[model samples]
Target: MDLFADDTRLTPMPIDDGELWFQQRLPLDLAPDEVMRRLLAETGWREEEIQVWGKLHKQPRLSAWHGEASYRYSGKTFHPQPFTALQLHIKQTVERVTGRRFNSVLLNYYRDERDSMGFHADDERELGPEPAIASVSFGAPRTFILKHRHLPKKVQLALGDGCLLLMAGALQKHWLHGINKERTPRGPRINLTFRLIL
Candidate 1:
């Protein structure tokens, strides 16, 4: 038998100029499917418009913010609604696993294969220096792509159901990441990114 096979901890994903830790599945009281269903039924998702190059356009995906602080990006400010009980629990679990405290969460819902996000980094000034963000996913899998800002390098991750990914260190300073739209039909997905705003 292979030693360390049963270890249920986040594995370090080596990359230049950044730190990544991933766990294929996070143990929870309820199943990932159940959590997905609950979030679908409970969240007040909205399709917000943002200005890109001086033109406003609706974001491809629906999203909600829940936390104690306001967030600003893309020329818009979002004053979050209070976190739900389930979201609070999720934050607690994420904090316990990652050893990081997060006061905010940005939840994004990809309704289908057509929904996608453009490449960007979470390098906002309010995040302070060397910030850490924990992302948890439920439901359909998606290919997450990361591209270096000034280098010809790329990385990909298959973000599956119940998986957790942590982006830390100089990642925001050197890399950009996003999810591209896929042609094939796909089910819905929800991703919650836990963060601490200074």
Candidate 2:
């Protein structure tokens, strides 16, 4: 597939070493509030302890795994949960947009401003080289940060409700991305990242 196809809905980001496509809002028809409510009520959200620097600490946010393949991260293996109706619908829609097939999804639920994720790259072996990650956000808006691995350049964007961020090409190999904690008040937010696990 042509990575830089001239699509009216896709806005190419200005990053030197990677290809990113940003869409402020996706045409999912479902309201953001309704999606959040369904996910919260149906999905099994859990907090797992991760080992960092020889110490174990509880993850700041809730997470769930759903799809056909298992995922391993932070030295833990996550068995896949059967995809719910809502998840399957969203997955199909995203697949149509990116023209990519995804077999797994990792869902992160940020309860409030205090919940945050540290900077990290998604260049895991299972994802293969030049993996394409389709991220969809719902509910509260959060700032997404991407920093070049060896350069003094950074890209920051606010991912509001219903926004879709596609990270493809060599982005994960050359840059790191994360969502930082906010001091001010904010509502809950959910980020779903669909991936193809080889």
Candidate 3:
């Protein structure tokens, strides 16, 4: 499939040695709030622990893995759960907008101000060279931080409700991206990152 041929609405985000495209809103069958509510109730969510630097620590957020492939990260392997009807609908919508194919999805839920993820690259070997990752967010907005690996550069993106962010080309190899905990109270938010596992 020619993934980039028909994507006309995505705005390019500038960065060194990487590619990014952002759409303020994604096309969906249901309202973003309704979808968020369904996701909060129907999907299975897990609080996981990861080993870092010989120490085990619990992840600050709840997550679920879905689609055809299992995923491994942070010294743990996540077996896949078959996608729900709603999730499949979301996956299809994402595919249509991005014109990219994906066989797996990582769904993350941040309950409030205390949940966060540190800066990290998604350049796992199974993602192949130059994987295209599409991120779709629902609910409240949060800052997405990106930093260059070898340059004194940083970018902060406010990923709001129902938006789409596509990270492609050499983005994973050249930059680190993450979300930080907010000092003030924030509303619940959910993000889905779709990937094609090789």
Residue by residue across 22-121, what tens digits does model 2's lDDT show?
A: 8777668698789889988889999988877778899999999999999887877899999999999999988887788998999999999999999999
- Candidate 1, position 195, lDDT: 95
Worst 10 residues of 3 by lDDT: 1-10
Candidate 3 off by > 4 Å: 1-8
Ranking by TM-score: 1, 3, 2
Q: In candidate 1, what are the lDDT values of residues 1-198, reduced to their tens digit?
A: 011112378878868899988888876788999999999998999999998999999999999999999999999999999999889988999999899999999999999999999999999999987989999999999998889999998988888899888999999999999999999998999999999999
Candidate 3: the clashing residue pairs are none
* Colliding residue pairs in candidate 1: none
Q: What are the per-model numbers of colliding residue pairs?
A: 0, 0, 0
Number of residue pairs clashing in candidate 2, backbone atoms closer than 3 angstroms, sequence gap of 3 or more or interchain: 0
Cand. 2 TM to true fold: 0.94
Q: For residue 117, give model 3's deviation from the true position in Å.
A: 0.8
Global lDDT of model 2: 0.88
Model 1 deviation from the true structure expressed as Cα RMSD, one decimal place: 3.3
Assess every candidate by TM-score.
0.96, 0.94, 0.95
Candidate number that wins on lDDT, 2 or 3: 3
- In TM-score terms, candidate 1 sits at 0.96
Give candidate 1 regions above 4 Å deviation. 1-7
Please list the C-alpha lDDT of all candidates, in the order they appear: 0.91, 0.88, 0.89
Choose the strongest candidate by lDDT.
Answer: 1
How does model 3 score by TM-score?
0.95
